[model samples]
Target: MKKTVLPTMLSFYAPDLREQIEALPEGTALIGISASGQAIAVDLDAEAPHVLVCTSSGGGSTTVLRSLTAQFLHQGAHALVLDPKRISHLWAKGLPTATHRGNVAGIHDALVGLGEELARRLDLADSELDAAPRLIVSVDSALAALRQLTRYWETFRSKDDPHTSPAVAALEAALWTGRAARVHVILDGTPAPGVLGAAPHELFGTVILARVTASTWQRLAPFTGPAPKPSRHSSRGHVIQQGESHETQAIWMTDADVVTWLTDPDDPQS
Candidate 1:
């Protein structure tokens, strides 16, 4: 039997999701990966879904803070979310996707293979996999088994390059198609709406910051519109008026963010 990396479902909610999801083939279900207080959801099979990204602000309310449309992974659809907080709604909809490698020879092998696979896909260096495993299998009863198997991954290596770390390889694969796939990233905390950190530019583009304060929008004013013309605030001094009005100060993104989406990986404008 071929060794596979199965998706280990974590402590996810939504009884409806469970009902609709379980009916899906293991490869055709929505899987969630939660780490470092962050939750990211993906559609492993969403070749037809839009890549809608939702971000949240601290209101303790799981209502739609803001919504945006961007070019997504799948080729033919639009994505919209009522709220960034209610990400569980995606599951309830039975959105089919996951980062799972697939069924292995039972729990033990499944867990270990997944860790090794994750290390290979996330561009993690061999040294990084020492004691800390960034990727995890969220399935029940299998967590312990997976923990036991990942230990052996310390010895696993890619075929072409013996020294190529598992994480590094995984990162490379993740940049494109691979054993597992992610759909929409669920932002629980406030940060850049679509930031992938100091990661390669290929990692992310067209991030929509959900909400911004008037002052915050002002900071980006220079980038937002026409240049500030010389003003006679005082002699020998020039000032630029950013145009007044409470609503003008409000934050909003341009259609460019939507037009220049990541799906068009070939697009230079992206």
Candidate 2:
């Protein structure tokens, strides 16, 4: 008798992935292709609002960040990249509308500046924000940065200062009030409860889980309903938004591909 064989689910990558990127609707960024051959994307303005990517080490979170950042930047938004490890998203270095911070001190300063900017925007009317450029803060590793920031504050905080780190407070503020200000954050990390002053799902509108276990999802994103089973295919994950789960294979982006977005003269066809 022949042994029973189970068919493995195959991941799809478009041959014209760049074209798919070019064709993304305004305010939407192409994330990847779904298992059923649909383009998976996130709307920065409305649907997603803000994104939190939860994945284990080497789970391709940086790739997702780069793809999203490239599209947002192409659409005229500025980006602030907080990469304490200093290795991810090297293509962003020296880009005109983008700034990269590698050290914990610099990351803290950037977050503080972002908080201040968010406050300024909150004072403006809706018409003013309509003409204002959007801002994306891409944190490569939220957990690591939070740990470093806590230690940094502990070492240098004055007695008069509050016990909690101001940087963390600023981040929490942004999470709470940034959408109306056109300031959005795309964070990739394994964050625990209380780290962000709320549950992960509460802080971010869109949560992308990559190569994470079912328990991780249940704990961090119970609001998304039951988690998808683990897949043998690489680059597979679920994008949970508005209570629906969309299984997807994340877009594969090379550094060269991302650089074009920075230098391509704002023309998608160019």
Which ten contiguous residues of candidate 2 have the minimum total lDDT? 3-12
lDDT for 95 (candidate 1): 23
Model 1: lDDT of residue 25? 41
lDDT of all predictions, in order shown?
Answer: 0.27, 0.78
| Tens digits of per-residue lDDT for model 1, 176-258 | 43323232222222222122233211222211122434443344232344323322211111111222211111112133322
Score every model by TM-score.
0.24, 0.88
Model 1 CA lDDT for position 36:
26
Error of 1 at 165 (Å): 18
Model 1: worst 10 consecutive residues (lDDT sum): 244-253
lDDT of 1: 0.27
lDDT string for model 2 (212-254, tens) is 8878888767877777776665556788877767777777666
lDDT of 1 at 267: 60
